[model samples]
Target: MAILELAIGFFVLAVLAGIFGARGVAGMSMEIARLLIIVFLILAIISLIL
Candidate 1:
């Protein structure tokens, strides 16, 4: 839940940064968001399996 929210926050940041023309920050935020979403999904799947 928290991780999902964090990921969402990062995604929003990326979108806003991109709109503002901050390519580096947008790219970095997007990467971080992707990582966080992957981690969150993995954790969710593990939790369900366990």
Candidate 2:
């Protein structure tokens, strides 16, 4: 849940950065958001298995 929240936060930040014309920051934030979401999914699956 926390990881998902962080991913959402990063996605929001990416959108804001894109609106402000900070392409680099926006791209980085988007990548971080993607990574966080993947991590969250992996953790969720592991928790369910255990």
Candidate 3:
């Protein structure tokens, strides 16, 4: 699930980059990557705790 989201995020970023600009793509991709990392860590911790 997490991987899928991350993949989609990157795909969107790539498309946006080609259509719009590098800056927008970079910003969005960074944000998505950050969020994905956070979520992935949280899920890992929760699974370990349980």
Candidate 4:
């Protein structure tokens, strides 16, 4: 559930970025990718621990 939420958030952000961001789009995309990866890893770790 959390993972799905995070993915949807990432997708929405990507779409917004595509529409509005031109110069900083590359950096924004990379940062979003990194954030999503971190979120996934953290969720995985928590699930495993629980």
Candidate 5:
């Protein structure tokens, strides 16, 4: 799903930012990734139930 892909992309961005020593950016990106993943999971569950 698009949300999952966005989460994965953000995860990769976080990793790269971390490697580059951008702690703030990395943290923000990782937080976004986590949120996206949670949203994706929720959507998937709702879709399944429906």
Candidate 6:
């Protein structure tokens, strides 16, 4: 849940940065968001299986 929220926050930050023309920040945030979401999903799957 916390990871999901962090991913969402990063996604929002990426979008805002993109709007403001901060390409580097936007890219980095987007990458972070993607990684967090992937981690969250993996953890969720593991929890469900175990």
Which candidate has the top score in lDDT? Answer: 6
The residue pairs that clash in candidate 2, if any, are: none
State the C-alpha lDDT per candidate: 0.99, 0.98, 0.73, 0.70, 0.98, 1.00
Worst-scoring 10-residue span by lDDT in model 6: 39-48
Candidate 6 lDDT tens digits, 1-50: 99999999999999999999999999999999999999999999999999
lDDT string, candidate 4, 1-50, tens digits: 66657666766676677777663764576577677777888988999999
Model 4: pairs clashing at backbone N, Cα or C within 3 Å:
none
Question: Model 2: per-residue lDDT, tens digit, 1-50?
Answer: 88999999999999999999999999999999999999999999999999
| Residue pairs whose backbone atoms clash in candidate 3 | none
lDDT for 36 in candidate 2 is 100
TM-score of 5: 0.97
Judging by TM-score against the true structure, name the best candidate.
6
Once fitted onto the true fold, the runs of candidate 5 whose alpha carbons sit more than 4 angstroms away are: none
Which TM-score value belongs to model 1? Answer: 0.98
Residues 4-41, model 3: lDDT tens digits: 58857776776677577687777777677777777777
Query: How does model 5 fare in lDDT?
Result: 0.98
Off by over 4 Å in 6: none
Which should have the higher TM-score, number 3 or number 6? 6
lDDT of each residue in 1-50, candidate 1, tens digit only: 99999999999999999999999999999999999999999999999999
- How close is each model in CA RMSD to the real structure? 0.3, 0.7, 3.5, 3.4, 0.4, 0.2
Ten contiguous residues minimizing lDDT sum, candidate 1: 39-48
Q: What TM-score against the true fold does each predicted structure earn?
A: 0.98, 0.93, 0.61, 0.54, 0.97, 0.99
List residue ranges in candidate 3 displaced over 4 A. 1-21
TM-score of 4: 0.54
If both were scored by TM-score, which would come out higher, candidate 2 or candidate 3? Answer: 2
